[model samples]
Every structure is written in structure tokens, then in C-alpha cells.
Target chain A: MVIAAIGIAAAAALWRRDGAPAVGAALYHAWELFLFIAPSLLAGLLLAAALRQLVSPGALARWMGAESGWFGLAVATLAGALTPGGPMAAFPLVLVLAGAGADRGALVAYILSWALNGFQKLLVYEMPLLGPDFAIMRTLVTLPMPMIAGYIARRLPIAWEPPK
Target chain B: MTGGQVFLAVIALVAFGFCLRRGPGSARRAVVDTGQGLWKILPIFAVALPMAAFLAELIPADAAVAWIGPESGVSGVVVASFAGGLMPGGPFVTFPLVLAFAKAGAGVPQMAALITGWSIFALHRIITWEYPILGWRFVAIRLIAAAPLPIVAGLLAEAVVAVLPIGLGRP
Candidate 1:
């Protein structure tokens, strides 16, 4: 609602300066963009939804908690990439997995992977808005990041003794 | 439609089919989830897409280039990374804002850094969820561990752009 209001105000300001035509031009461009992205957007949402249903959070958490070392990080990274929804979904699962004895390094890897490589975010938002080329390039660069970060976290001297 | 778009569609269909094979209830749930997601995003898209268009016009190309263009190099990536961390809202807001920056001629590496920063730093998420549920120790370690990623991603993007013929065209 706030964003829409701000957009309207901006449009009105543009209209006053550029005479209605500028606002019209912006609208036209927006509509063109909408048409361009609509198909992919729908498809992406479907993919996200299907993926979410296919993989249960319980199974994922169990998988993460059971692994350790480099392989654990890899599994956590994969789980993070596969996890669906936003913070609400991912964070709770993270908490559960952590409480269930998931490795600290693996958890870091999981969070990083969720942030950087989650297919839901990539497909539903990134590819549609940023285009596939940029998305692909970014994804390629990001693929190795979670494991690297997780490995570093494991080496970090600071211990995570959970609040009692 | 672009190949990317077609590829997305095919994947979506296959995934949906897989869910259906698993059970009708799961397929129904997927459909419901998709509808809910659409409902959530549509209004935001209505405003954001146009906002991106106007922003493309309003943002000075020279400023964008000076701040985060290909010529701006490592410093540009650093600046973009911080800016991205500060950007409020979810993917719906962030991606459109990135689109505006891209249209205004921001560098590919800079944008890559920006997105990475947004994803990892995620101050809002950390404060809201991570701190409360995971405790301060966990948050600190996560932040420290992931600190270098955005810069790395930016440099990697720059290298890729140099090697590849393909470009990140303005959407």
C-alpha cells in the first residue's frame, strides 16, 4: 500500500513536469515489462509451489542433522537450495535442524545456500526480473560460496554455545 | 518467449506433474500455494514494474556509471554491496530496484554484488528472525562466515563477463 501510494505520487509529479505523456510513457513501459515477464512469473510460481510440496521440511532437517564434515556442508547447502518459501519457512526449519544437532558449519552453509542459491528465489524473482543471463552468471558464481563460508565458519574460533 | 522462459515453463510442468503423481492432494496444495503466491505478488508488481520504468528514466546514467558501472571496479562493488544490504523489503522490491539500477547502466558485477549482499547480510531477517530464534552467537558466526561472499561474487561476475560473449541486456 505504501509503495503504491509512493508510485502514484511519483507519477503525479512526473505528469506535472512532463505533461501526462511522461506518465503515459512510464505506464506503457511498465505494461510491456509486465507482458514480457508474466509467462515466466506464472511458471516460476508453479515450480516453487510444486517443489515446496515435494520436499518436506522434516526430511530436510533430518538429512542435515545426520551429516557432518565436508559432506555435511554439501548436504546443508543442497537443502538450503531446495528449501522453499521465505524467512518464515526457512528460519523455523533452521531452528529445528539446529536444535536437532545439525553441525554449526553445516547450518551456516544451509543459511548461505538458502540466501544465495534457493531455486524458488532464483526462478520466481531473479530470472523473471533480472533476466536469465544475469541470473545464470550470478548463480554460477554463487554455487560454491555456501560451502566455502561454512568451511570458514567451522574454522572460526568463536564458539556458538546456545543460550541456556 | 525466450528460451529461458520456455525452460522455466517446462520445469514447472514437470514439477507439477511429479507432485500429481505423488498424490492429488499434493497437486491441489501446490495449486493453492501458487494462487496464494500470485495474490501476494500481483499488487506489488503493479506498482513496482512501473516504478522501475520511471526510475530508469529518473536515475542519471552518469551517476550510475560513476557509482557502480563497469569502470568503477572493486570500489563500485563494495558500494553496491552496502547499498543492497540497506535496501528494505523482499525479493519483489529488491529485484525491481535492481532492474532500475541495471536499466540506468549499473555494472553486471556491481549488481551481482548487490544481490549477494542483500541475500546474505539480510539485516531485517537477521534482526527479526535470526536473533530471536537462533541467538546472538549463531548470527555473529553466520555474518562473519558470509562476509566475503558478496565481493567474491562481484569479482567472479566480472571475470565471467570478460570471458563470455553473452551480456546482461537491459530487461
Candidate 2:
């Protein structure tokens, strides 16, 4: 809602500043982007949905249920990148992992991995919007982050309790 | 369509085939899920693209370059990372805004830092999603552990761009 309002305001401002022609040009460019991106966006979403079905929550819990060491962290990170969708899809899996006895480090890795470079976001947004070069570079740079953070998180004195 | 688009379509098809093996029911569900997801986000896309375009127009390219261009270096990356953490909303909102910044001449490394910051430690997500569900103890540890990631990612991206023979940071 707020985003819509802000967008409207921006459009209005642009119109006022440079008249209809500038606004028209902006719209034209936006339209062009939309056209160029629409096919990939639809394919990416379909791919995400299909992949989600393939990796069921129960399977995910079983895979990460045990092991709190570096291997566990690596698996957790891979799972996070593979898990599709936004927070609504990913966070519940975190809950499931916690419930299934995944450690704090693994959980942290999962969240960080998803947040940083979840395949769904990469395919749907980054690749189409920023191009493959940018996406691949960003992914490579941040790829090690989840494990590194998870390793540190594992050493923390904090205790873990699954959310009720 | 570009090679990327073709690649995406081929992957989607292969995945759909796998889902079909699971059962026609599962295959249908995947399509239904995609439809629903598209319905939800299409409006955001419509708004975001125009908003990005207008904002790109509104913010002068010279200012963007001065603040986050290739010449701006580590300090610029640090500033971008901080700004990224403060950005609100989801991918729909953030990615379009990033695109706008890119169009306005933000550097690749700076944009990388911005995205890493947004992903790693988005304050809004932590408040709305993490703190409430995961509790403060978990949040504290996670934040401390991940704190340096954005800047690190930025610097790493810069180094990669420098080292690679291919032009890796153009976007």
C-alpha cells in the first residue's frame, strides 16, 4: 500500500517536473523492461513452484535433523539456497528444522543463505533485472558467507529454543 | 528471447516434467501455485518498474556516480551497504530500486554491497520476521556473526572485478 502511494507520488512528481513527455518516456521504458522480462519471470516462478514440491518440508527436516558441525552448516546453506520463494516460504522451513533438532548454527546458515542468494530470487529478480554477470558475481562473493557466519554463530554462548 | 530466457524456460520445463512424475496432481498444484504467486506480485511489478524509472529520472546520474560510482571505492560501498539495510519491503520493491540506482550510474561493487546488506541484515525483516519468530537471543547472535558480510562482499566483488579478465561488473 505504502509502496503504491510512493510510486504514485514519484510519477506525479516526474510529470510535474518534465511534463507528460518525460512521464511517457518513463512508462515506455518500463514497458520495454516488462516485455523483455515477462517470459523469464513466469518461467522462474514455475520453476520455483515445481522445485518446492520436489523438496518437501519433511525431507528437508530429515536432511538437516542431525549434525551441528561444519558439514551440517554446509548442508544447511545448500538447503537454504535451494529453498524457493520469499520469507513466507523459507522461514517456516527454519521452524521445521528447529523442530526437527537442527542446531542454531545450521539454522543461522539456512536463513543467511536464503537471504543472500536463494535461487528463486536469483532467477526471478536478479538474473532478469541485473543480468547473469552481476548475479553470478554477487553469488560467488557471498557464497561462503553462510558457513562463515554459521561457524561464528555456532561458537556463540547463546542457547537455542524452537519457537512455539 | 535471450539465452537466459531460453535457459530458464528449459529448466522450468524439466522441473515441470519431474513434478509430473510425482503425479499429475503435484504438477497441477505447481502450476496453480505459480498462478497465485504471479497474481500477488504482478501489481507490485507494475508499480515498481514505473517507480524505478521515475526515480531514475528524478535522481541525477551525476549525483549517483559521485556517491556510488566505480571511483567512489570502499567508502562508497560502505555507505551503500548501510543504505541497503535501511531499505524497506521485499524483492519486488528492493530489486527495482536497485535497478533504478544502477540506471542512475551506481557501480557494480557498490550495488553488490547494497544487495548483500539488504539480504544479510535488512532491519525491517529482522523486526517483522526474525525477532518475533526466532527470539532476541537468536537474532543477536545471527546479527553479530553476519555483521561484516556486506562490506566484505563489496570488497570481494571489487577485487573479483579487478582480477577477472572478463568485464564482470558492468551491470
Candidate 3:
């Protein structure tokens, strides 16, 4: 937060030096973007929270545990993609899954899926800003990443353990 | 409102309804969580949107085209990927910058690479969120395992564009 504040302050100073009109333009653009995204952001958070309540850790673990194999990876990937919120919402659920005995591979896959192709972000932000074509193309290109990464993580010689 | 916003609103309404049916406690929890998430995200947006506006105003379309435009090719993708990792903030900030760059004439492949790199190697996310929550070992392994992804995706996107240029819908 502090860093963001400092950045804004610095940018404001730079824009002010550039011209009063520039400052006004920048502020106007920011306000417009905020208004555009505010509803989606709020809805996304609510959806994420609701999901957290709906899906139990036991179910998450069962669906994405070590013994669940490729199916587990698929489930993890889908769950990660479907999850609606940011890292704060996703990571705690991950921690819970880890505690409930999800494998290292599943965990890694879950994180990668969320990072690369989170459905909520794609729908709310990416598609909206970048256009549906760009969003779809990117999604197609990235579809395999989480699974590939998960497979590699599973096969790596390193002794991978769940985060303590 | 955009189609995406309408879609999100529907999802939110359904989720809220479900939570409400589950219990008042659940609905309250959702509200509290939403508040916290908003708090975390707004500051980043506050800074990033202005930065994007500034970039949009300052950078020329031709310069952006020369650097990360289609003619710039693989090198442009590499540079974009690196920039994406270094960029701080969440999607609210990152997407607008990409939009700015696109409007300034960045190629689709470069944009793809940028988004990929931002997703995987964002230093802010790695340091502030992933490490603290998942621990160093997991983070390291995941980083190493996924290192080649953005570049590969970028290259593939470039190839796809060459074969079926219309499919990518390049700006």
C-alpha cells in the first residue's frame, strides 16, 4: 500500500510538472477505469468468498490428492481456473488443501492454473479490456501450461514436500 | 456496462443468493471478505491507472510499433515478457497497461508473452503473496518448473498468427 501511494505521489508530481491538463486527464482516466471495474471487482470477491464456504477442504483434497492422479490434476486445474478472487482468496484455500493432503503436484498445478488462466479474471478483466478474441487466443495458448508444469514438478528429482 | 460486467454481475448475484440461503453468517462473511479484497486492490489500481494514462499520453504509436510491434518479432516478445515480470500490481493495473501498449501498436504475440510472464513471474506476487503463503521451497520449484512457459507461449502464438492471422484478431 505504501509503495503504491508513493508511486501515485511521484506520478502526480510528474504529471503536474508536465501540465495541469495532463494531471486532469490522468485523473479522469483513472476515475473512469475505477467506475468501469468496481462492480466486477465487488462481485468477484463475493463469488470467491461464497466458493470458499461452499467447497470443503476435505472435498478439495479428495478431488486433487496424490492418489487421484491425472484426474486430480484436472480437478485442481479446473478449480483454480474457476476460483474468482486474487491470491489472498486462493492461497488460503491452497493452504487448506495442502493441510488436507493434496499432493505437491496438484498444489503446484492449482497455483499455475489460477495464475495463468483464472476464469474470473479472464471474464471480468481480460476479455473486457483486451477483447474476446485476444482473451480466447491467450486462453487456448495457455491451456496446457498448468498440466505441463504439474507433470514436470511431479517428475523432478528434488524431494518435494508440501509447504510447512 | 460491458458484457463482461453483466456476466460478472449475474455471477455475483447468484453467489450472493446462495450465500444468503446458506445463512446470514455466510453472507456476512462474503461481505467482510469483499471489503478486505477491495482494500488490497484499490491502492494498486490508484497508482497503476494513472501510470497507464501517462504512458498512453507520452509514448508514440510508431515507437511502440517499432519496439513490440509485429515486425519486432521474437526479441520484442522477450522484452515484453521481461517487462511484464517487472511490472507491479494485479490485473486491474496490468491489463490497462497492456491495453495502452496495444493501442500504441504492440503486437498480439508480444502482448501474449507479457500476460504470460506477468502471470508466472510477477515479482510482486512471488515475494508478497506466494512465498509467504506457500513457502520458499514450493515457490522455487514452481518457478523453476514453469520458467520456459511464457516464451514458449509467445513463440507459439507468433507461429499461429503466421498460419492463421485472422484467428488472432490482431489490432
Q: For this target, which candidate reaches the highest DockQ against the unseen true structure?
A: 1
Q: What's the distance in Å from true for residue B125, model 3?
A: 3.9
Model 1: per-residue lDDT, tens digit, B1-171? 887778889999999999999999999999999999999878889888887777776777766998999889999999998898888778877888888888787899999999999999988888898899888888889989999889989988988988974345333
- How accurate locally, in lDDT, is each candidate? 0.84, 0.84, 0.76
lDDT of 3 by residue, A44-143 (tens): 6666666666654336567777778788888888777876668888888888888887888888888889989987677556764565567777888988
What TM value does chain B of candidate 1 have?
Answer: 0.91
C-alpha RMSD between model 2 and the true structure: 2.3
lDDT per residue as tens, model 3, B33-134: 777866876776677667766666666767789878987898998988888889887787788778778768888899999999999898998898888877
Residue pairs with colliding backbones in model 3 are none
lDDT of 1 at B121: 92
Task: Report the lDDT of model 2 for residue A118.
Answer: 94
Model 2 lDDT tens row, A50-137: 9878885435555554365778888888888998877888887788888887878888899999999898898778777776667878
- Show model 3 residue runs off by greater than 4 Å: A1-18, A35-46, A49-53, A56-58, A82-95, A119-137, B20-44, B127-137, B155-171
The digit string of per-residue lDDT tens for model 1 on A66-163 reads 34777778888888999887899988888777876787888899988998878888988898888777888899899989998899888888878643
Model 2 spans > 4 angstroms off:
A62-67, B163-171
